[model samples]
Target chain A: MLSETDISAISVTIKLALLSTAILIAIGTPLAWWLSQTKFKFKVVFEAIIALPLILPPTVLGFYLLMTLGSNSPLAGFLEYFGGGSIAFTFSGLVVGSVIYSLPFVVQPLQNSFSAVRIESLEVAATLGASNIDRFFTVAVPLARSGFITAAVLGFAHTVGEFGVVLMIGGNIPGETSVLSIAIYDHVEAMEYSQAHLLAGGLLVASFVMLIFVYLFNRHFSLVRSRDW
Target chain B: MIECQLKINLEGFTLDAKFSVPDQGITVIFGPSGSGKTTLLRAIAGLEKGDSGFLKVGDSIWQTDDNFVPTHKRQIGYVFQDAGLFDHLDVSGNLNYVKKRKTGLKKVFIDSIYTLLDIESLLNRRIGQLSGGEKQRVAIARALLTNPKILLLDEPLSALDLKRKNEILPYLDSLHNQLEIPILYVTHSQDETSRLADHIMLIEDGKIIGNGPINEMLTSFEMPLSHSGDAISIFEARVISRDTDFNLMHLEFNGGQFIVPDNALPIDSLVRIRVAARDVSITKKKQSDTSILNIFPAVVEEIVPEGNAQVIVRLTLNGVVLLACLTRKSSASLKLDKGSSVFVQVKSVAILN
Candidate 1:
C-alpha cells in the first residue's frame, strides 16, 4: 500500500539511477581503458582521482558539487544559458552528483577487467587486420563483459542508496528531485514510521537482490568464459 | 619475397637480423628459447617496433624510416604460442569476428577454413570447452578467416602436450601443402622444423647462423649439429615402393636407396630422410649378411674428435655429405681417417617429411 507521492518518488529514483549509471558507463569505459592500458607518468594521480569518491564522505563531495552548480557558477550559468533553467535544484543536478558519486564503482572494475584481458588477444586481433576500434569492441569488450556487468550493477545500486549527496543537492522536491532515500528520510522526520518502513524495506531488498544478482551472474559468466581458454 | 633488415634493442638483448624468405613455402625460424625468433616474427607483423628497420612483404613496404604502418593495416595473421582465442566468443563467433572486418574477402572463405581446420563440429561450443588441440585448431581457423597475405605461426605447437602436438600436426601439414600463402613458422623443436619447414633459418643468440633449404641446412657441418658431437645428414628422397612383407617403405635419393619404417605415403611422394650420425656404422668392407638394410659406398670427408670418448666422421656419399658418430676406440680400431673409402651401414633412419 504505497501512496501516490511514494510512487512518484520511486519513479524519480529509478530515472536518476538509470540516467546516472548510463552516463557513468559511457564516460568511464574509455577513461578506464586508458587507465588500464597507458603507461603515462601521472597514471597514479588519475587513478586516485577516479577512486576519490569511494573514500571521501558523500557530504564533502555534495558540498563541492552544489557550489559548482550554483546559479552564480560558470558551469551553472552555461547550462542556464543553454537550457533556460538553473541545474542547481533540478533532477539534472542530482544526476550529475550521482554520476560522480558512483564513478569509481563503474570505473575501477572496468579498469581491472580491461587490464585482465590478455595482451596476446589484442595483438592477435591486430594481426588479423582489425583496427584499434575494431579490436576494442571485438576482443576487449567481449572479454570484459563480466566486468562491465559488475560495474553497471554496482553503479546502479550505489546510486540508488545515495542519501547525503542527493539530500544536499536535490533539496527534497517531492515529485521531481526527491528520490526514495530522501523520501524515506522525510517520512522518518515526520514520524511516519509505517511509510518509512515500506520505502526502507523496498530499498533494502533491492540493494541486496541487485548485489546478489551481480555476484552470482559474474561468477557464472567468468567461470564459463575462462574455462574455454 | 619477404625481406627484413631490423635492428632493435630489448632489455639485455639486441636483434640485428637480416634475412629474406621466398614468397611461398614455410620458412621456419628454428632456434632455442629466448633466441629472438618470436621477436623477429612480431617485428614482421608490426606488433613490435624496431629502432631502425626496413620491411617489405610481397611488394608493400610496411616499415621504413618515415612510414610505419601499424599492425592493423598490414594483411598479416599471427597465431601465438597460446592460441589467444577470444575466451568470450564461441568457436564460430571467434572465426567470424575477423571475417567480418576483412577487406579482402575474395582470397579465402570462412567455409573453407571450417573444413580445413575440421572445426565445424566446434562452431557452437565456447572456447573454454575446447581441448588444447581444439583451441589451436580454432585459432588457426580464425587466423585463416582473415585471408591474410602471410601467416605467422609463433610457436603455435609449443604450448601443447606431445599427444596434442601429434593431433594437430596433420592440419598444419595440410595447411602447408594446400595453402599457397607463405608461412613464417617459429619453432624451437627440430622435429617440427624438419616436418613442416621447406626452408630453415637457424637462429642463435639473436642472429641467423644458417639459412638455406631444410635438407641442406640440416647437413651443414658448420652449424651446432657438428658441435653436438653427432654427424647429421638430410637426404631428399621420394617414395619409390613399399615393402608390405617387411612393413617398410623404399626411398630413392641421389646418394642411394634407404628403407624407413613408415606408412601412409604413396609412391613418388617427396620426403626427407634423417639418418642420425650415431646410428651409422662405417665399415671398410661390405658385409655379406646383416640386419642393416642400407650399406652405401662413401668417402671419408673429415674426421673430428668430438671429446675424450667420441669421434665425429663426416662422409661424402655420391657427393652428399653425411655424418657418423663413433667411439674413439671404434675409430682407432677401424683406422678411420679422412680421404679413406668406407661402407656406411645405417643402423636406423627416421622419415622426417
Candidate 2:
C-alpha cells in the first residue's frame, strides 16, 4: 500500500514535469527553429551548449545550477533586484533545473523536423501573400506536427525521471520539494522497502503508458495520408 | 507598355536584358533551356533582385535604383513549373487562401474561375488527389482569384506529358481570349510558341536576340528561327466552302483562295494555317498537269544560302510572305534571283486551332 508521503511526492513530481514541459515548448520552439534555419558561424557553439546536458553528469549540472541560484552569486543579485530572493531550494528553481536537463530531448527532434521542411514550401507561401510570421505559423508549424509530439513526450518523460538535479536544488522539504524519486530515496534510507517499491512502481507504469500512447498515435495518424494523384 | 532593364550575375553566366512588352497580350519569353528565360521572369516579378534596374508596370514603379517592392506586395500572380499548390488544402480552400488577401472585391470568383478552368468537379478534392493537368488548372485558377494585373507563368506546361499538354492547351487559349491582362509566359517548345504567343521574345546566351509579333518573327530573314524546322507562315483565313465529294475545303485569305484537304472546322470559321517551307516548290510557269492543290504567282524577294547545296527563297504571294527551300541545282536551272516572278506550289499546310 502507498503511504501519505508517497502520494504527496507523486503529486509534486507531476507538477514539476507539467510546468517544465510547458516552459520547454514555449522557449525551445524558437530556439530549435533558429538552430535549424540559421547559417551563422557560431551555430556549432549553440548546438554544443544545448546538447551538453545530454552527456554531462546530472550531479555536475546540479552543482553549477546551485552556484548560479545561491544568494552570493551574480545571477542571484540580478534576480534580487526583482525581489525574487535566493531561488535555491524552491519549487520554481527545481523547474529551471529540470528544463535544462531535458533541453536536448525536446529540441533535437524539433530541429531535425524543421530542417526537413522544404524551402520551396516557404517560398510558395510567401508568394501567396503570407508574411514571415504568418508563414511560420501556417506552414512550418503544421508540417512539423510529428516532431512536436516526439519532443513533448521525451521532454515530459525525462523531467519526471530526473533525481539528482531535483534532490540537489529543491531538496526534500516534505509536501514542498519531495518528488517521487526523492521519496523513494528516503524510504530506502529509512529501511522502508515496501513504501519505496510502491512509489517506484507507480512511476514506472505511468511513464510506460505515456510513451506507449505517443507511439500508437504517431503510427495511426500519418500526417495527411498521401493520395495517389 | 512594360519596360524592364536588368543586369545580374548568376553562377557562371551573366544576364543582361532590356525589353518593352505590350500591356495586354501574351508575350512569350522564348529560349532554349538554361538561357536565363525563367530568371528574367523572376526579376520582373520581384522574386529575383538584381544589382540595378527599373521595372515600370503600367506606371507603378516596382523597382528602380534605390526603391523596391517585395514580391508579395506587388500585384502579380506567379505559377511555377510544378503546381506548387498547398498540399494541406482542397482546391477551393487553396483559392480562398489567396482570396482572403484581396482588399476591395465584394464577390469572390470561386464559381467563374473554377468553371472556366473546368475544375468545378475538383473544388472539394485535396490537392494530392488531382492529376498533373488537374493540378495545373487549379493552380491557374488560384492565381486568377488573386486578381493580379499581370500573370507570370514559368514553364507551366514543361512538367506535363504531350497528351496532357494537348488536353490543357485549349483552356489556356480560352483564358487568353477572355482575360485582357498581360501574361508573361515562359516556354521552350515551338508548338506552344506558335499556338499561344501573340508576341515572341527570343533569348539565347542570356541576351535578347529578337522581339516582335509572331508572324513577323516567323518570316524575318535575319532571325535564325526562319531557317529551322519552325520556319512557317501563319495566315488568318476563313473557310468559304467544302467540296465534300472531292474531300477538299476552300479557304479564303486576304490575297487568294486555297483548296486544302477536308478538315474539322465548319465553313465560315476563321482558322490559322502554318505552311512549311520545305513543302513548297517553285516553277517558272503555271503547270496545268500538276497534282499540287495550291498555285499562286509570287515575286522572289531574296535568296539566302543554307549551307552549300541548298538556298531558302523568300517569296511574297499577295501580301503574305513565306519561305521556300529549293536545291541549288533547281535554282540554277530556273534562273531564280531577287525580283524573279514565278508560280509557287504548296503541297500541304497544317491547320492550327
Candidate 3:
C-alpha cells in the first residue's frame, strides 16, 4: 500500500523528469553543436566548466544552486519584480536543479555524436545547395538522431534518480518538491522498512528498465548505422 | 568564361593560381601530386577561402575584392575524389536532396541526367551496396541535376581501382559532349588528361606553368607533360572507313589517315584517338613493304634531348603536331635536327570515345 504522499512523490518525480529533460534538450542541442563545430581558442575552458558538474560531488552543485536561487539572489529578485516571488523549495526550483545536475548526461552524447558526423557529408550538402541552417537540420541532425535519443533518455533517467541536489534546493514539501528518491529516504529515516522497500524496489526496477531501453535502442541504432557505411 | 585569380595560404603550402578558361568543353587542370590542382578547384568552387581573389563564371561574379559567394550559391557542381554521397540516403533520396533544395529545375532534365549517367536502375539501392563505379555515376548524376554553370570534378576516378576507373571514364567522356557547361577536371594522371582534355592547364608547385589547347601543351618541349616517360598526343578524328576483314578502322585527322585497330565504331562518327610518343619512330623515307601502316611525311619542328639516352622530336605533319621519342644515338645517326624533313611512323593509335 502507498501513502498519498508517496503517490504525489511519484507524480512529482515524473513531472520533474519530463520538464527537465525537455529544457535540457532545448538548451543542449545548440550548445553541443557549437562545441562540436567551433575552433575558438578558449573552448576548452568552456568545456571544462560544463564538465565540472560531472565529477564534482552532487552536494557541491546543490550548495551553489541553493545560493543562486535563494530568496535574495538576483534571479529571485528579478522574478520578484515580476511578482513571481521566490522559486526556492518549488517545483520550478527542482527542475532547474535537475537540469544542471543532468546536463553532462545530455550534452556529452550530443556533442560526441555531432562530432562524429562526417565533414564530407556536410560539405557535400552545402555544395548541393543546402544553406548552413538547412545543412544542420537535413544532414547533421538526422545523422545524430541516435545521440538525441540517448541524450533524452539519459537526461530523464538521471533527473528521476537525483537526491542530493533536490534535497538541498527543493526541500521536502510532499506534493511540491518531494520526489521518489527523497520519499524513499523519508520512509527509511522513519524506520518504515516495508514502505522503504516498496519505493526503493520500484526505483530499482524503473532504472533497470530505462537502462535496458537505452542499450537495446542503441544496439538497434548501431545496426542501422553499420548498414549506412 | 570562368576566370579566377585565387591565392590561399595553408600551413607549409600556398596555392596561387591565376587563369581564365573558356566556359565550354573540358578544361583539365593537369599537374603532379602536391601541385595545388585540387586546391585550385576548391577555390574555384568557393569551398576554400582565399586571401584575395576574383572569380567570374559566365555572367555571374562569384567573388571580387569586396564580395564573396558561398559554395551553395555559386552554381557549381563539385565531385570529390571519393564520391561524397550521403550514406544516410538511398540513391533516389540523394538525387532528391538536391532537387528539393535547388528548385525550378525540370523533371525532364533530372530524368535525362539519370539516363545520361545510367543510374535510373540504381535509384533505390543503398549507397553502401553500390560498386565504386556505380557510386561515381550516381554522384555525377546528382551534381548534374543541379544544372550548374560549371562542373568541377576533383579526381573523381582516383579513388577507384583500374577496372572501375576504366569503367567510369567513358561516362565522364560523354558528359562533355552531352552537357553544354564547362567542366574543370583535375587529375595527376597523364593518361586521363590525353584521353579527356580539350584544353589543358599545367600547374607545378602552386603556379600555372602554361595553359593552352591540349595538342599544343602536349607537344610543347618545355611542358612537363611532354618530358614524362609516358607522354602522349591526342587527335580529334573522324571514322572515314573500316577494314572489317582485318578488324581495323581508318580515321582521318589533320595529320593524315590512321588505320586504328577498332571494330565497334561506324563510319562518319567523330572520335578522339591517342598516340603515345614512345610508339612513334622517325625515318628519312617511307617504307612500302613493312607491316607498320601509319606513316606520314612531316617536318621536324623542334628537337630536345630528354635524358642522356632519349631525344624527343616535334614534327609538323600537315598542320598537326606529333611527338616522336628517339634514342640520342639514332638522332645523331639520322642527323635529326630542327627544320629537317622526316617521315613520322606511328606504331599504334588508341581510339578514345
Candidate 4:
C-alpha cells in the first residue's frame, strides 16, 4: 500500500544514513583512537565536548549548524567563493548534520574499543619489527573489530531515526532531503494513516533488528574474549 | 660483544646498570621481583627510553647521546611474561604477519620454527583457544619468525605452572643450542637460570652484582647467589658409559665419575648436570658402605653463614668448585671448618641439558 512518494522518501533516508555513517566512521576512527591513547591535559574536556551531541537537543545542534553553514555564514561564503555552493538545505547538509548529531554514537564505541586493546600486544609487535602503521592494522584493528561493528550499526541506526536536526537544516525538501521520518510526519498531518503506519512499522522493525544484531554480536565477542583468556 | 650502559631515573627507583654480554649464548639477568630486570630488557629493545645511555650491539649503536632509534627500527625480538599473542589471529596468521613484512627473508624458515618448537599441530588453532604453555610456545615461534638479531625473553615462563614449565624447558634448550643468536633472558627463578643460562648476570638493586659463566658465578659464594635455594654447581660432562644392569648412567667431569639417574640420552653425548646445595652432604672421612654411590674428595674453601639455622659451605673438589648447604648444628657437630679435607656425598643431581 506504499505510494511512489513514500518509496522515494525511504530510499532517500537509506541513502543519507549510509553516506553519513560511512563519513562518520572514516573521520571518527582516527579521532577516537587519538582520544583513547593520549594522556594530554584537557583530554577529558575534549571528550565531554565531543559527547555533547548525546545530551544536547538535536534541534539546537541543527540550528547552530544551519546558521554556521548557511550562505550568510563565513563557511558558506568561503565555499561559494571556491564555486562549491552553499551547504544548507541540501543532501550534503543532511549528511553533515547527521554526522554531528550522531557523533558520539560512532565515537564512543570506537574509543572504548581502542582503549580495550592490550598495549603489550602493540609493544610486542614493535619488537617484532612491525612498523607503527603495520602494528595498527595487524593488531589494533583486528582486536577492536567488535567495537567497529557496534559503532557502525549504532551510527547507521541513529542516523536513520534522526528527525530534529534533519528537519531544521534540510527543510524537508522532497526527493532531496525529505527522509522517511519527515515523510511519515507529513502523512500523519494530512490524515493519511495507512501510509504513515507502513513507514513507521518499517522503521521500527529495522531499528529493532539492528539493535538485536548489536546485542548478539557483542555477546559473541565477549564469549570469544573470555575463551581466549 | 653487546655492551650497554644506561642510567635512568624513575619516580622512586633509579636504574644504573652497565654490562657487556657475549655475542652468543643466553645471558640471564637473574634478580628478585621489582629489581628492574624487565626494565633493563625493555631498555635494550628500545621500548623504553633511558635518560642517558649507550647501547652497542656489535658496532650498531641503537641509543646514544643524539641518536635514539625507536623499538620498531631495532631488530630485536621481545617475548613478554604473558606471551602477548594477538588473540584475533590464529597461530599461522600470527607467524605469517611478521614473515610477510620481513625485507630480506634470509634466515627465518617457517618449517624450521614449526619443527623446533613443535608447533605444527597448533598452526590452525586460534590464539584464544590455546593453553598457556601453547601460547608461550607460539609467541616464541612468532618472535623467531621476525628474523631478529637478538631475542629478549622477559620471564616468559613466569605465568605457567610447574608442569608447564617442565614441558617448555626442552624447547628453550633447543633454541639455545640451535639458533646461534644472542638471548637476553630475564628471570627471578634460580631453577630456570641454572637450567638454561650459559652466562649469568646477577642483578641486585638495579646493579650487576656478578657476571660470569653460570657455573662459576653460581658456586662462587662471593655474591648473593649463594643464598638462593636452587643455587647449584653446573658441570659439563660427557657420557662415558651406561650401565643397564643397575639403571644408571656414568658421566665424567673435572673431578671424577658420577652416576646420574637419567634416560633417553645416548652414550658419549655431552650434557650439563646441576647438583643442588641441599642435595650434597660433606663428611669428614670417606665412608666404605652406604646406600649412596657417588662420593668425591673435597677441601673446604669457605663457610658462609646463611641464617640462624643454615650455613652454606664452599668446597673445591679437584678443579671444580661446588656449594653445599647444611644446618648450623650439623656443621658444629662435625666440627667443619676451612681447610678441612672432606668427602662430598651427592644425594641427587638434575640433568639440565
Instruction: Write the residue-wise lDDT of candidate 2 on B143-243 in tens digits.
Output: 87777788889898999999899889998988888887899999998788878888999999888999988878888888888876437777778999999
What candidate 4 gets wrong by more than 4 Å, as runs, is B104-108, B228-231, B262-264, B289-291, B327-340
Say which docking band candidate 2 falls in: medium
Ranking of all candidate structures by their DockQ, best first: 1, 4, 3, 2
Q: Per-candidate TM vs. native?
A: 0.93, 0.92, 0.97, 0.94
Which ranking of candidates, highest lDDT first?
3, 4, 1, 2
Candidate 4 lDDT score relative to the true structure: 0.89
Q: Residue B19 CA error for candidate 3 (Å)?
A: 0.4
- The regions of model 3 sitting more than 4 angstroms off are none
> Candidate 1 on A116-136: residue-level lDDT in tens?
998888998888778899889
Q: Candidate 1 — number of clashing residue pairs?
A: 3
Better of 1 and 2 by TM-score: 1
Cα lDDT of model 3 by residue, B83-188, tens digit: 8998778899999999898879887888889888998889989887899899989999988888999999999988889999999988987897788999999998
> Residue A60 deviation, candidate 1, in Å?
1.2
Output per-candidate TM-scores for chain A, rounded to 2 decimals: 0.95, 0.94, 0.96, 0.97
Model 1: per-residue lDDT, tens digit, B31-141?
Answer: 889999999999889988987899999998998977899998998878989898877777878877886876556543767777899998999997778999998999888
Cα RMSD for predicted model 2: 2.6
**Superposed Cα deviation of residue B245, candidate 1 (Å):** 5.4
Looking at candidate 3, what is the lDDT of residue B337? Answer: 84
Residue pair clashes in candidate 1 = A227-B128, A228-B127, A228-B128
